[model samples]
Target chain A: MSIMRLLLVEDNARLASLIREGLDRQGFAVDWCESVAGAEHALKINAYDLMLLDLGLPDGEGLDLVRKLRRAKLMLPILILTARGGLDDRVLGLDAGADDYLIKPFQIPELAARCRALLRRPGASLGTTLIVGNISLDTAERTVMVGGHTIEATPREVSLLERLLRRAGHVVAKPALEGALYSMDAEVTPNALEACMSRLRKRLNAAAADVQIRTVHGVGYALFAPVSTDG
Target chain B: MDKAGNRKTGPTGPTLFRQIALRLSGFTLLFAAMDVAIVVVTYSSQPESLAQELLSLEAERVQSATDTDPDYLAGPPGADRWSARYIDDLGEIAGASVGSANGGRLMDWTRRERIAGGYRITGVRSVVRHGKQHWLLMQFEGDGIRPYAPVILDEIVQHVAVPLIPLSTLLLIFNIVAVRRVLKPLRQAEAEVDALDPDNGFHRLSEVTEPREVNTLVRAVNRALMRLDEAMAMLRSFTANAAHELRTPLSIMQLSLDRLPPGEVRDELQADTQHMTRLVEQMLDLAQADALAPELLEQVDLADIGREVVAAMAPKAFADHRDLQFACHGNTIVLGHAEAITRIYRNLIDNALKHAPGQTAIDVIAGPGPQLSVRDHGAGIADEDLPRLFDRFWRKDRRKTDGAGLGLGIVQKLAQVHGGTAMVENAADGGAVFRVTFLAAEPAKPA
Candidate 1:
């Protein structure tokens, strides 16, 4: 499998560097640009799996590029990363052809989870069933199995497991995971998504799943193959 | 500006131009009607006098004729166009000419009698002709001598028509121009009031050109504006203070935590900062949405906004094994701020997604009430919880911490600011439905 490459278009140098380092540690290569013009130049010379676009740029509004790219019929998934977290701004970003929206002061894990979700789209050259170590999820069937033994999971748990397995070994954002585990129409209590995740984790461990889901403090959840310390 | 003094309904009844025009027209019509009545009265009161004049002329003509010839039964030929009659006191037809009236043969002499060419004038007189009593009734073409008042009136009208018609017209035009000029300052005051912009800052209405009465109104309006300006300034400061005091530390902590190595400790710190940041941002948004003025409202398509929000959140819904659908039958337009309306959709959709059962489809529908309603398929909300659902920081389960519990409160506030209402109710089968209704926009006019 080839490693996914991403383009980050943001004006803030510090935030750009932090996001770049974080994604680099997540087994992806990220190319950073600080302006719309620079980002355009990078896109012309190289291919990227996704582009994290910031709305406010030095030269112009970032949405202009989104409009231009959509006009050109370029099928690249553009995720909007901006300090503008207003509801209208989110709608505008999505209407302007952005695939995802993340407000400023966002967590690296959430950003990573969004990138994973976008990469796992059908045309992104990724498989349907997500696998990490011995655990696998068939997104089509909403099923989860470990060590070739099908584990009993509610549909909600399977959906949650699907999200964690897709971004295996990397922190999956809590909000993103919650979004994945329940319908927005559900009357979920506060942190109820977390409660559901805890139950799913226990079920996976009870089934002796080789992969273990780890909570990354306030960040999110990560699934990784446990180290064999018996040697 | 004493409220009791301004309660005079007469002052507000009509414009000066209208009042003057109406009075002048009414006065002109009254004079014209009086002139007509005078002519009618004068002509009607003089019929007896006209008959007496004709009788004396006939007597003179007959007496002279008898002296020339005592048996004269008619006046001399061509003496006058009027034909005279001679009758004895016993009321017998004494003599008659080819067309002369026979007075003794008349049935009623008190009233004017019709003759061949014109009317017959009858008069009773004992004329001593040959020492005998005789009555003379004159029949003539009295059409030649009409009533005197009509002739006088005709003369009067001819003399006055040229000048009076133009004079009244000039009076009417002058009244219009003078009234308009007098009211110009009041109109100027009205225009100034219309142009005042509260958003631009404090602008006192101009009292310079306004009449004293209008100046009072200007002062009252300016006073109200001052109160609004003060309130706006306070709100501005509150937002500024909140921004400076809360966001700075949150930003600093988030940036500092960014440098921490990848671990559970750093992750927890980051999540806490994220939560705090969300709360601060939402608080500010709620304040802004609540304080939006009516003038800031805009025309927007509710369905298009719904579709965009649902499309934006569809991935999250899909990941949760739930379906998000937007159903709109027709144009759902409303007058509202785009930001406030968008927040309404975002918060409602978030609530529905979080509260409903897993794998349930959530539908965002543009309803016939010109409202946007988000319907879920999970169990409906409890009757007790419905009332407090929109209260700040109120939650059915306090232990759940996905949100600061301000989302619904902000939704209600935003709806209220747009002159709309937010309502929640249970669907027929199950699940909770959240609805926000707005003022429908005027339909698009044809070009």
Candidate 2:
């Protein structure tokens, strides 16, 4: 991956500068602007791969910019940054033509990962068999396998694992998992979730898989793709 | 003031209004008593003074009689009743004979005699001047006009009664008026205090035109209002700051999860997002609740909200292999916001299902306050843990669980906002019970 140019529009100079500095260290060139007007002018004057926008601005909200960009039919990736993470706000951000969204005070790595992933999205295949190393979950068969051993799973458990196996090395939150598990038929408890994950993790480990599922405290799950020790 | 009466500052046990009233009435009573005492003592002795004056006038009349010559002393002037004494040797009325009206001889005599019906019988007593004898005088006696009792009494009344009557009456009127005038400000201050509202209705009683006695009170009230205003301002700022700090990270975590590699990874991210969202929302709710103005209140049904929450939680319960059931006292309506009651039920059900083992029965009840309880066949909280359950982020086990710790705290907050309360206890039949209660509306009487 080459260094990508990012346009960061945020009214708060301190946070914008900090994010820019962090992203710069992460090998992305960030052009910072203080308002929507500045951002619009910058977009007209230059070409960029992605735009990072803070929704709180003196001139306009980030969502409004996303809307305007969408109306103008600009194809650049727009990630909305907002302090209000309300459900309606999240829905509104995505609905307004934002390619992705991030909440404030984000970790440099998480922000970087999202930015990289969003840039990669347009060129990626939706139907590709997601693979990391030798452990493979075949979408066609909805079966998980590591080194020729078929992993046995309940139909629901298979579905749950299939969703995770398809997106290896990304953080998955709980509600997203809930949506996939049951559709208004059953309610799941935290304990139930723990139980499901425990059984799933054991099944995967039993197949002598190289990777493991990691729990992120106060957050959700991380599918860790094992790295070659010699790296 | 202390027992030593040092400065005597601040509000006393008795209000200043009462003290002033007591003082006013005390002075009024004291003045009334003094006026009465003066009237009684003077009234009791007036007769003695009048009698003395009358006697002196009679003595002068006797002198006049003797001075006119003993032969001329035939009858008393303004004759009435008089006394006389006969002496062994007659004392001269300065060389004139005297007559007495009535007398008794004991020794030397002191008498005022009437000469109207007398023959020079020892004359009106004066001094003896013959034959070395200490004599008293006799006087003739008759009833014509005594001229003493009425005349002298008239003079006394004309002088003393006229002066004392106006003085006592003026003092009494002045005392009453002064006492009442002094109490006017206190009465106004008391009325102002009574008019105060517990929910910030009034700040201070204006005392620009009030008496000096209550100026301290006005100033104290003003200071208290200032402090209250400062406290409220601080609370508002705290709410805003907390909301900003807490909501920002939660939003970030949630937003970052979007476009998450859609599969198990995304699913885990979504769970994290939900946990973070729940925490953020609970914090926001707490902040909003503290700043709530009661005037924004609207009528809402707790029972309906309870049912709605139970419905919402049922899917989650089924996912966890738990059964959520609700029994209600039908039509259990209360006046409050539906969302708050909904939050109460959400937290209660979330709590019950979160902790309970799979396939356990969870029962929810809504009724006329105190009767509503959410029963979970989960591990019941210990007696000691029950008190701390409503505390924010306080879980009985320190183990970091998949769920946020703010659920029950939100329930308690909603309960407070509804003018009700929430509590938890272990059921006798083996379960944890969460009970929310609103004040039951008074039952309608027979029409």
Candidate 3:
């Protein structure tokens, strides 16, 4: 069977190489591009299960590229990697067609998890159910089962968790998580979304022994992988 | 001169542009005065000479007419004062005004009780023996005639001089208009340069087509903007990536320390963790402040933010042995972002608590004429330190304080960011009062 294809577009050579190597260790076949031009050519030549885009590309503007990619009918899940603190820019990036955004200087494990989650999205050539230990989530039906014990979640929670479980080792910001909680049109306050996060953190508490949710303080929250060695 | 010199550095007021224009206009007025002086000098010297020439011509004509026929020079029958001599004799005589030297007279027959026409006739009587006959001959000057030429000359001068006033007035107007038109591009370039957002890292100076001298200047500015945008973009990504990557190590460090279970080692570790947390928070705050778009102009309530900050700090104030109080009078509407406004107040309150003598109270009063003053009753600043108080990373006694000394600098930047101003003064009651004034939004009127 063909392994998952991940496209990591980061301008920093060292960081990109480190990420590619780590994702390779996690069973992902990784290809790295440093700029928008390289990324474009790479995307054209080979199909990617997921495209990890850094907003600060050297050649052309990353946002413009994301817009271009979407305009070209490329439905590959794009995860925007950015370091900006402003909600406005994040909103603009997501609105421009990024499925999710991870702030810069991300943990490699979380990057891999987000990559897998994106690859596991419905449009992925390889249709796979997300199985976190015994709990399995069906992307098609958007259903969840834990040891045959089914629990109903709000549509928003399902969407939010899908993104979290997909990038289980990384901390996600409240705003980006909030974007997943609602569709492109809905208005969710930082506080209201905080309330939902409270609910999700509590539910995940039962499985806290295997999985951990950590807060980055003033930033957003993050979900850690089971084998998160350092965290 | 100053603005022209600083033009390379940045934007300036109309002071220098006006200075040059004023000097040019002074030259114009000087030129006008010189033109008037020339007319007066030419008129004073030439009119007498011109009158003598007119007398000679009249004498020659009368002598010739007397020699040809004596009756020709005499007056016609029934001729009155107003009738032209040319109408009576038709060719031999012309009655007009006399010259100024001849008492400013006009024409009349026999020169009796001369009424002014266009000239005056002056009389000179001479007796001479011609071939044994003593003849009494009256030599008369056509008084009206001399004044006639210069009057036409004066009329020509008047016509020319009259239009020049309006023309120069028009020229003055035209000068002002022309200056304004030419300076338009320069002014536009200045405005665009002024509007460049250092925070956004996105400034497009489309006004590159300036005067040849400044075209390169605009190009240089755009280049600088390009460099800034690239650097900022890189910084943004680097910060984000670094923040994310460090989290695992940071959490692992915390988790490893957390598992040590509340002992000396753990306490030390926790303190270190908190310190790290503060560092992270600072980095994030600095990154945020850097990324803040200067274009976020809004009518924010400083008083409301003040109250909120004070209320939020109530617990911290009690712990620090200080009082955080708010004295807001009314809705203080100033144009700024809500977040920045809140941050400004928070920094001010934090600074007061951090610097004030222990057990002293800090009172913040907002909502007074677009100005928010923060007063602390404690050891006030020395006059020496007042000027440099707002400089970044500047602290008079860092050992005595528990901050990075960025609070006041942040406040100052906040003041500038909101199109406001800040002033420092020691209040009479032995305290340092920092007043931040965010000018109220101008009320828009109907067109």
- Docking level for model 2: incorrect
RMSD of each: 15.2, 14.3, 14.8
Model 1 error, position A170 (Å): 18
What tens-digit string does per-residue lDDT give for candidate 1 at B143-199? 335523344455347544555678889999888787777677677766676676544
lDDT, candidate 2, B368-419, per-residue tens: 4534678888767777777788888787776765655778877777677667
Scored by Cα lDDT, where does model 1 land?
0.72
The digit string of per-residue lDDT tens for model 1 on A41-63 reads 99999999999998878899999
**CA lDDT of each prediction against the hidden true structure:** 0.72, 0.64, 0.63
CAPRI-style class, candidate 1 = incorrect
Q: What is residue B263's positional error in candidate 3, in angstroms?
A: 4.8
lDDT of 3 by residue, B322-400 (tens): 6566677665787777766777777788778877788888888886778788889877889999889988778897664
In model 2, how large is the Cα lDDT of residue A193? 63
